[model samples]
Each structure stands twice: as structure tokens, then as C-alpha cells.
Target: MNYSLFAKVFVAVIVIQSFIILIGGQLNIIRVDRLIQQREYEYDRKDMLVVQDAYNHKLKQIRTNVLSLFFDSTQSESILEKIKRYKGTTKAEDLTLQAEIQQFLQSMAYTDESIRSILFVRNSDEQKFAFVRYFDPSLLPNFESMISLKEDEFVKVYPVDASPTKQVLIFILKVNDPNTVGMKQTVGNLVVSIDTGFLQIEGDPLHADSIIELKNSNGTIRMSGNSFAADISQIDLDARKHDSKDYFVTQVDNTVDDMVFTMLISKKQLKQSLFAMKKNQWMTIVAIVFLNVFIAFYISRALSKRVNTVTRNMRKYTPGEFVNPILIQKQDEFTVLEETYNQLILKLSEFIQKEYVMEIKSKEAELQLLHSQVNPHFLSNMLEILRMQAIKENNLNLSDTIYQLSEIFRWNIRNKETVVTLYEELYYIEYYLKLQQFRFPKLQFRIVLPQNLQNQRIVKFSVQPIVENVFKHAMNKGKETDIHIQVIEAYDSIRVSVKDNGKGMVADDLDLLILKMQKPLADTKDTPSVGLMNVHARLQLIFGEPHGLEVQSQIGEGTKVILHIPKNEVGP
Candidate 1:
């Protein structure tokens, strides 16, 4: 082979032709893939829209069913008859009531599977705690909570339900009087439990390369057709990119229930018709590649020596085994090319080293930050609960511990609200005490509240940490911590006292601590007892002027932390 200008021109032509063929093949394949992906995405979105419409219709049917039972003259007679008869906590039904309900239920009129129970809640002071005309209470265990259902829905995945199918969807409708239109007067409530999972979406079931899911606002999948994403960590719920060349995904949000229906489809399944042509195209590219490669292989031997010299020097980059720039005597393009590549390689090497080390360090820093986010005190309490679970055979205690911990975290991490219900606060306190009793083995606690005063609003996490402070400062390792929580109506306001029976502080120390709590807490780096300071600051922030934590302790008895906020200024 002659190494001349004519030979070089022929080699360049062959190389350029091969490059074009290769680029064409790649671009064609990419275009086809893009088309297939777009088609899949559109189909998934279309299907979700159809399903969303179906779900809407299904909800309407449920609402209609509830309305029909109330509006129909025949059903109305029975519905009113129950109110007249089962006034309060009527567990047993009379023959007439039973016969009427059984006949109505057997008519199989509603959208639900069957009638679990027909509860008519009559309006009265004592009736708030009782349901009137409750029938067939076997299937509906603790159906009383349905009284607090804020909105109507097809509740397919209730947390408290442990049914094997776990598919009991309930529809609760507020009953109004007059049995006519435009009536908002609350006479009673209707509780209807549907057995079947709202089988509204029809046609073929999802195939292997597809999935359907109903996800809540938190991206928690409430119900799914198949066993996918059981351990949610495996799937990225918040990923921005919805589609890829291989698969497609689209979401349809149902505003009524604040839930989303997701449909996913595989690109392979979507391009069933175009797949055959893809095989032929690949075969043609293979043939062209072989021919172009054959001609280029023979024509390109003359240039290989120079190219190899450049690539071989480039390979010496690893392990910092590099040399100075080459001193080529030949006055041609290869010499300029090698020298240019050498400078480029040096700059690229420096860039990679800096970025690689920096990225590794940044990732380590991020992981360390995440690890620190897990509070040590919270972890210790959880570990203690686990220890209780391991030692005791009683599942009830374990359940209570888990429930309390869940409620605490629920209020802590998820709820960013400034105000909360005192009832919820008290519930959290009770659970914390129960767990502490298990840990201390002798810790006894009692909560005494004024009659009907648990509904007042206060700050979030206001009471639990104060009671924890009691256990920390007052109780001894061996002795039981006797803590009493009392809520009483003071002069135009409410006073909450958390009294502990352990070693108490002196007057001087008590005064100092109260003084510290009275002042506003600034966002400082080093602060002792964050729990107390944060709670104190939060109370004062919510309720103004001399309304914060008060500490009173004696030498031997114990300490009492008093929290005073207005009955008028309770919020969020």
C-alpha cells in the first residue's frame, strides 16, 4: 500500500461513507423508538382518562344509591320508621324493622355488595354517642367511626380494616329531613358498606407489560391490580421523567378524593406492529456495516500506525503514568493532531479527578446528613419498644407501643401545622405514658380533664415533650414515675398541669428554669434541652403575654410544669 495523497483521499472517502452509514442506522433506530414511546405514552394517558371517567361515574352511582334510599317513598317509610323506633343504641331490631330492612336489602338495589347495617343517627344530645335503628352489626365492626366521615368516597383501603381481601369500600351520606329537595337539615346519617372493589373499569385486564394503581396524595398506593411496588423504595414515586424508550407512564388525578390513578405501559407492547419492520431494518444495517467495514478495513491500513500511536499514548492516562509531549520530526497533520490531543487529554484528566473526588465527598456528606436526621432519643424509645415486643408475648402492649410511636411520628414529621386538637395532644400523651410505663416497669400516670373539654385547640407536639421532661428530670432508675395530667377551667381560660412524683428542684433552680423558658428562643447552634425550649417558645408564639411554661418544685416531692393558653385564641 502506497502512503500518498491519492491513497489518503481514497481512505478518507471510505471512512466518511462508513461513518454516514453507521449514523444513519443509529438515527433510524432512535426515531422508531421515539415514535413507539410517544404512542405508548398517549395510550397510557388515554386509558387513564377512560378509567378516571369510569371512577367518576362509579362515585356518582354510589352517591345516587345513597340518595335513592332516602328519596324513594317506600325506602323513606322504613328509614323514618327506624328513627321513630330505635331511638338510642337499639342493638336488637323489631320484626317490622327487620322485615322492612331485609326486604329493602334483598332487593339488591344499591351499588354496594350487600347491606352490612343500616344506621340511622337521630339528632339528640345523647344520640351523638349512640346510633338509632342499627341493624346487622356483625359485618360492620365498630361502625361508629363512620359518623365522623367528613366526605363521601369509595374507601377501598381503610387502615384499620384487616379483611383478607381488605376491599371493603364504604359510602356514608348525611341524611336530611323533608325527604324533598333543597333540605340541608341533618336528621340522620346513612352507612352503606360495599363489598366489591369498585369494579367500574371494564374491558381486558392489564397484561404483563402494564400496571394500574390508585395512589393517594402522599404517593402511597392505596390499591393496585397486581403485586408491584409492594416495597415502595424500589420505585421512584417523585421522578420527573415519566416516559422512557422502553416504557411509558401517565397519571390522572381524581380531585374528588385527592387520589391519582396511574397507568404504565411497555414500549414493546405498544409497537407490536412496528416491531417486525425493526428486525428488517437492523438486518439491513448489519449487512451495510459488514460491507462498509470490509472496504474500510483494506483502505485504512496505511493510517492505522499513526492512529495507534495516538491511542496508545492516551491509554497511559490511568495510574498517572504519562510522559512529556511527543517530538515528531515529520511536518504533517499527525504531529499537530498528537500535540493537540495531548493538551486536551491533560485538561480532561484534571477535570475528571476534581469532579470524581468532589462528587464522592458530596455524596458522603449527604448520607451523613441523612443519618443525623434520625433523632437519637426517638430511636432509643423505638428500640425500647422493640425490646418490649421481644420479651413479652402479649401483642396488645406491643400494638399500643407501635401505635403511640406512629402517632408521635405522624404528628411530628408529617404534620407541619402550627395548631392541633387538644384531644389529639392528650391521646399522644396517653400513648407516651403507656410506653414509658412498660420501660420503667412502675411508672403510673393518670389524666383528669373537665367534662367535655378535650376539643380545645393548642400547638402541635405541645404536651408530649413536657411529659417526657417529667420522666427525664423527676424519675429515678429503680423507682416508679407517678405523673398526673390535669386540665381544669380557670378564670375565663384553661390550665394544664403536668405533675410528677420524683426528686424535685429547689426554688432558685426552678426560678432560673422558668426564666429561661419565658424568654423567646432564638435559632442558635448550641441550645440545651431543645424539646422544652421549642415547646415553650411555640406556646408563647401562639398565645401572647405571660402565657407559657411555669415550673414549681420542692426538695423531695416532685416537679410540676404548668401550661396556660387562652380558650379564645386556639388555632390551626
Candidate 2:
């Protein structure tokens, strides 16, 4: 994908942050779920304890009521004497005693609604008196089975089938009579049939969806709160296993009856509660994630903007042209990059400037070479023949003028050196002015060279061009055009001033000419000030700046052009 820096940075941050959020969120969910399980398990344990206490209290009350009716009640002796003597009585007396025992059992059953039935069995003659309230008499165990219980076993419980579809628990207790020696004698057994409903919890369950059960020591369920019975084999009953994904089980031991109170808590309910509790946390995490995304986008966009600015400027760059430096408001790594780039651009500009100057010098040298290709010897011989003929015809002035022109041409072409001593240049200038005087009889000139600077080396043709410009542009018709050339020594350099007493230039024209001279020689080649610009460019290129042409002029007053050159000779 052709992703920009901004997109790449933003996506990288988001992916990393999302990964962290995913891992952290999962860990949080695990921790919260565990805490929910622990809290629910503790609550279920406490509720189970409460149920166990209530069961114990109910059992103890039932036991107290049964014991009082068997031994301490007012009818206890009558019931026992009647049960013991019933075997030897007449048929009529037996019926009367059976009726009396039935009435006593009826009174006990009426006292407690949970009491389904009560029975009194006499041990002496194996006689039985039973009263049934809620059970079928055919479902009772034989008298032999009831009496076979050990005397030391005071009370025992059993699950009895009351009908095909109903079951009840029976509590059997032994009745004892005291003898003269204070020893107790077994009289009979009292059996109480209790409705299984009494084993159920009294109030609503702790959890509406949970299952509560009361199981005997053998793991058989005696009473249950919910009709749907949970499979006991699926769980490790001995270990009291609770850590199940489907259900959280809690078992409380009922010491009073050796039973177990078990509560099955659904894990689905715990998960619902956990979700509700973590709703706010999830919202906060989402908010943080969004905020991080925005921050990532902002940062990436800002960096990209800076980079694009730098790149755009780089694209605009061209050799020998000015490129503006990049501007950045913030101070960071980009600032350093901007500074380095600006520095590099500055260095490049300098290098291009030097190359341009060298190129101009090369072109000028090629022009000079082209001009030099002509045979200088033929021209010299022709000019010498003309001068000799003028001398033979007695025209001395013409002969001298022809000789000066020949010397100037030979000096101009003979040497390829770019620098020449001041004395030779001044001598060449004097010869040129003499020839110009031949054409303009009223022209006047002066050459004042200092003795110490006569041998100072400077660029060739630097002085002659300025003097020639005076004749070409500064001459005033019908008046003497006076020219003055002087060499003055200054600090670390020499100034050759060429003054002309001809019609001078106006301020605007002088400024234009000076401006043209200041440009690169190649740029000013076709301008009217080419000769002046040429001299200025050569001086600056050879001796470096502060050593070029400077002009002062005024209309109708005069014009002076100064050539500045270094005092120390330097090769071009």
C-alpha cells in the first residue's frame, strides 16, 4: 500500500493500543468474573447456614413434642398400661383399650400439622396400636421390623412410602419404664410419621433460580425447593466441588441430623451481574481508546505537514536560482532538519555562483581566441608598408600615426596573458589617445602614473576600454574634449581614474550604466555598457569584489570612471 507517513504512524499506534486494550480487557473480565464467583459463593454459604439452623430448630421442636407425649404427658401412663395389658384383656376390654390408645395418638397428631401419623407398639405381647392421619396403613412396615430396632438407639429416621406418588419421613423412638431398683425396662416403641414438606425451607430461596436440597447421609434427597432435581452424580459430592462453569455448588453439613444442605447457584446469573458491574469500566476504556486515536492522528498529521513543506521546497529548487528556506513553527527534530537543509541550499547557491562566473570567463576567452585566429603578421606588414609610404611622401604625422596603430595592434594580439604591468597599459593608452587626436584635432589628454605603481600588474585591456568609452559617448562637438588619466595608490589596492571634459551623462543614465556594470558579464553582454561591464567583471573575477569599476558623472560637467585593482599582483 502507498501509505503516507501520517497514515502509517496513525495506524501503527492504533494497532498497538488496540492490542493492549484487548489484552487488558480480557484480563479484567477474568478478574471480575472470579470476584463475582467468590462473592456469590460466600452469600450462598451464609444462606445455607441459615437454612441449616432453621432445620435443626424444627427437628428439635418435633423431637420435644414426641418425647413429651410418650413419657411426660397426663395420658402417658394410661397409654403405656393399656398397651401392656391389651394382650390379656377380654374382647370388649381390648376394644376399649385400643380406642383409648387411638384417641391419645389422635391428640398428638392434631398438635402438629407436619405430623402425618403416630403409632404405639407394645413389646411384651407384640401388640400394636396405630393412628393414621395422612398415610396408607398398608404401606407401614411389619411390627416385627419395628420392634427389631436396638434399645440403645433412642431415635431413628426413615423414608417411608405414604402412597404410590408420595413419601414421608418417620421418626421411631423407644419407650422405657422404671423398676424398683431404678433400672429401666423397655415398654414399647413410638413411631411418628412426619410430612416430607417439613424438610423444605420456610421462606423464599436466596436466589430465585437456585436449587436447594436437603439430602440424607446416603446422598438421597429428602426435600427439595425446586421441583427439577439436579443430578447428584455429575458433581463430586465428597469433595464438595463448587468450581463448575454451569453451576456453583455449596454444601453445608447439618450436624443435628447428619444431613447435608446443598445450594446450586447458576453461573449464568453471576455473569449477568458481572456485566452490569463492569458497564462503566467498558465505557471508560472505549473513551480512552478514542482519545488515543485522536492524539495519534493529530501528531501524525503535524509531522506530515512539516515534512511536506520541506519536500515541496526541495522540489522547487533549480540550479542558479533562489529557493526560499522552509519555515517551521515548532522546535523539534524537524527544526534541525530545516536548518541543515537551509545551510545546504546556501552552500549550493555559492557553488552555482562560482560556476556561473567561470562559465562567463570561459566564453570571453573563446571570443578572444576566435579573434586571435586572424594572421597578425599580415596586418602588421600592411600597416608598416603604409607607414613607410607615408614617410617617403613626406607625411610625418601620418607615418607616426600608422606606427602607433601598428604597435597597439601588435601589443593587443601578441600576448595571451590576462594581466599586464601598469606601465605597459598606460603606454598603450597614450598611443591610442595620440591616434584619436589625429582624428579630432581639438582633443586633449593627460597620463599621470605614480612611480611606485608603474610595475603593478592588472587585468589586460582594463584601462583602454574606459578611455575609449569617453570618445564613444562623452565627446562635445565644436569644443575641446579633454581626457585625464591618473593612477592613485590606496589602502591595499590601486585606482586608475579616467576623466573626460566632454558632455557628461545624466543621473538616470549613469545609474543605469552602473547597474548594468554590476551584473554578471554574460548577462550584460548585449547591453550598451558591455565594455565597462566586461572590465568590471574581469577585475572582480580575478581580484575578488571591492576591486571593480566605479563611475561618477554629471550632465554638462564631466564623467570619471575608476578602475579598482589590488595592490598585490594576482594571476587570473
Candidate 3:
């Protein structure tokens, strides 16, 4: 073996494999980095939603308080009576009334922060002039549009001078009086401020930078607050454009569609961490590339040598030649490959022999065609004519004999199969016996066939020659010759015997007959004596030598031809 070529090719393959793995590792690292960043973005978006949900929850709490006060008829009536009683009181009396109003405000303060500011508003200067002059009306923003002069509830945005630098979210509520239920009369307006800052601060622990901003439909900021910002709108905008972090917006329905609540992540730390992750991932990828290269090189070198040896052996193996021994130097995957290849080589030789056998059979069939002895159509016509003549003479026995002879000639000429059933062989003998009876009706013939013989098959025309031999030789001189055909079924064989009380041969003559059957004699014309040769030849062809015909005789007594046929040869 040329180790040098194998070593050089193996080294080159290893190098190429290592290079491919290194490139693949680099691409994998980039993909992993991007995937991590995407996951972080998704997580941050969920966090922003959580923060916005908390803000909405706090606002819902505030709205609940406002609804309770708006629906409280008794408290509303009290506030209305105070406004009516103190409308035209003196400054000193109004001072006493202011004390009562302060106490009333204190009682309602716990309901919500928005409910503490309440004032009566009237356009009339003379009727309610004294109480109106005590407070700075110019300081309060417009509440006339909000007070339901006809019904009892209206909402208005009133800019407060208390926080004139910014803005206040206020709602105006009126208490209804039974006497003025269907009249256009306004007594006072209830004012309250929605604390946007407290809402954003509710869930600050979950959000990195929590912001809540209420904006009007026109995009003007109505309320803005955060743990860190007087103005959260800019940070909120940044959160929207980059929605890499979580951000969400909701509508505040208390004020017309005028207000929207937004919660957003407004810090850079979360993104900074993700960026640092990419840097660390690049460094990790470098180390991974080196490790993969080392592994790919080692694995490729080991795998290629074994694979190449199996390939060479497979390519060199040829059918119809003895297979070479595969030298397995290592007991691993290589050993399996070598063993499988060896099995394939052995199987190839067997297939070749089977194909060759089929080829020889094809050639032998051609030879049988050239050696045919009789004209089939002539033989058939002769047998049929003989059968008809025998029938006209009232000789049914002779007619059946001719029919049997025709069947024998037909079976032999066709030679459709090498084997026939034992029943078929018996039928052949029946015709031969009928012919013998016609020749000498005084000859008594008895046939005893075992029932088991019907299921068994034997070589074609097996019994014809033995029966023919008895008719020809034994019946030549006897006046009352008896022929007995007995078929006995043994354990693994069927025994067929034909016995005749005629002039039997001596031992020496029997031996000579057996020898002649074993080997062909020179004269074909005199060869049909017992047709023992022909019968023996066919038995050997169908079954084998150990199962051919046997003959026994005693001079001046009888002769018996015993055929031992193997039962296994019948069906299979």
C-alpha cells in the first residue's frame, strides 16, 4: 500500500473540512447574537406593557372615586345648600361660612385628591355679589361650559393658576335640586385634579424608566409626570420610535377623547447590556472556532483512512473469482465495512453460478429437439384407429388398452413435466394389462393398490416397462399364468411390485439384466427388452440412483420387479 499518497490526501481532506467548520462556526455565532438581542427586545416590550397596565390600574382607582362622588345624592345636596345659604352673606358671615365649607371639604378629601376644590359660579353680580367678591374669580379658569346649567353633570378643562406653569386636569360637577329639576339653574361646580405623577410612580420597580403622559387628541400634552421628569413626552417619543423596549398607550376617557395615557421605557442601560453581549459573543466564537477546527481535523483523518480502504476493496472485487480476505486492522466502523464487503463478494459468486446453470438448461433443451424419435401426429392417429377397431369387435378391454398406450405416448412426447402422480403411473399400467388380456384372456391378472398411492406422485411411465416385461416374456408359454400387481406404502417410501408366475430367470441372468440396465448396450433395436434401462434412466433423472428399479427372480418359479420410490420426491 502507498501510505504516502493516503497520508497526503487525508491531510488535505482534513484541512478543507476544518476550514468549512470554522466558517460555519462564525456564521452560527452571528446568528446566536442576533437571536439573543431579539429575545431581549421582546422581553423589554413586555415589561413596558406591564408598566402601562399598572398606570391604567391607578387611573381606574381614581375614576372609581370620581364616580362615587358624582352619584352621591346626599353629599351633593349638602354642598349645594351651603352654596345657597352663603351666596349673599356678609364678609364676616362669609368668614364663618368659609369655616363650615373647610370642614365640609375636609370630610370629602379622603374620597379623592381631585374632590377638595369646590366653588359656586354665577353670572349675576347683585344677587350673589357679596360671596363672589371674597374670592379671586379672575384666578380660576372658565368653568361655565362645564357646569350643567340645565342638567346636573358636565366636564371642562380649567387651567389653574395654582400650577399655571404647567396644567391641571379638572372636572366640574353640579349637585341637582328637586325644586329646580326641570329648570335652567346652575348653583356651583365641583373641581378636582388627576395626579398623573402618582400613576406613573405606582409600578416604578418593574420599569427601568417609567413615564406617564396624558395627551389630548390634538397631541398637546395634558398631563406629564415621572419619577425623573417634569416633561416625559420626549422620552415617550424616543420609546415609540425605537420600540426595542416595551412601550404602550391607553386612552383616559374621563376627559373627552381629549386625554391618552402612555407608559414607556426611557433609559439606555437595557440596550447597552445587549450591545455588550454581542462583544462577549464574538470573543466566545473565536475560541469555539479553534476547538471545532482541531476536532474536525482529527475526526476527518481517522474516518477517511478506513472509508478509503473499504472503497478500494469494493472496487477491486470481481464476481466468479475467489474473494480476498479483508484485513481489519481496527475493530471499529472499519471492521463492519470490511465484513459487509466480503459477504457481498461471496453472494456475487453464488448468483453467477445460478445464472450459469440457467444458461446450460437453455442449451440442453435445444439438444432434446434434435433427438426426437417418433412423429407425434402419426402415433396419435394409429392409437385412435386401433382403439376404434377394438371397440367394434366388442372388446372393451382391448379398446381401453389402446387408450392407455396413447396416453403413455402422449405423456412421453409432450414431456411437460418430469414427474407424474402414482395414480397416473397406475393408469399407464392398466392399459398395458388390458393389452395383455386381449392377447391371452386366459391369463389371470389381479391389481391391489394401496389408497395412499393416489396422493403420491412418481416419475412418468414408471410401471409400464415392468408390466410389459411380464406380458412379453412370462406369457409366451403358460396356459394359466397369474400376474399380481401389489403397491405397499412404507414409512417414507412407496413400494411397487409386479409378480408373474411364468418362467423366471436364474440369478446370473438377473445380474446380467441389471448390469445392462445400468449401462447402455450397443444395439438400440433390441434395447426395449424390459425397457428396464429406459425406466431406470427416468427414475434416476427424477429422484436419484438410490431409488431406481430392482429385479428378483427364481428359475422355474416367478419374477418380481420391486420399485422403491422416495415419498419426498412426489410433491416437492
Which candidate has the top score in TM-score? 2
The 10-residue segment with the lowest total lDDT in model 2? 218-227
Which ten contiguous residues of candidate 1 have the minimum total lDDT? 126-135
| CA deviation > 4 Å runs, candidate 1 | 1-33, 71-78, 87-93, 108-143, 149-168, 179-182, 195-200, 203-207, 216-236, 240-247, 266-572
- TM-score of predicted model 2? 0.45
Clashes of each: 0, 0, 2
Off by over 4 Å in 3: 1-374, 382-415, 515-530, 569-572
lDDT of 3 by residue, 1-572 (tens): 55798899998987887677657766876787578556644654454555456545544554444344323465544544554666555688776665666555455554544333434453344122112212233344443444434453344443332342343444444433435857346544444444334433554433535544445532344333334355444454533755644433332333333444444444465556656765565466567879899999988997887788778877777667776766667787668877887777777886787567445544554555445445665788899999999999999877887887787677667665557777766766776676666778787888887766676777666687787777678664746888888888888778888898888998898999888877622233332223777677556645666787788898888899888788854554
Error of 3 at 29 (Å): 89
Instruction: Give the better candidate number (2 or 3) by TM-score.
Output: 2
Model 2: per-residue Cα lDDT at residue 279: 68
TM-score of each: 0.34, 0.45, 0.33
User: What TM-score should be assigned to candidate 3?
Assistant: 0.33
Residue-by-residue lDDT tens digits, candidate 1, 1-572: 66999889998997787678767866876797677555756766777777677656655665665555554464535444455464344355665564555555445333234333344345543142122222333235555654544434323322223243343344555766655575655665655544324433343435555556665532343334444425322555346245475556677888777667766655565566466655576467668779899879875874687788788877775634445665565767677887787787677766676566446544653565466447744765675677577558667666666666666665555554557667777877787788787777888889987656777777766787788777677777777778999987788667888998889988898877767776555332322124766667667656865676777789788988888877853444
Best by lDDT: 2
Looking at candidate 3, what is the lDDT of residue 361? 45
CA lDDT, candidate 3, residue 309: 74
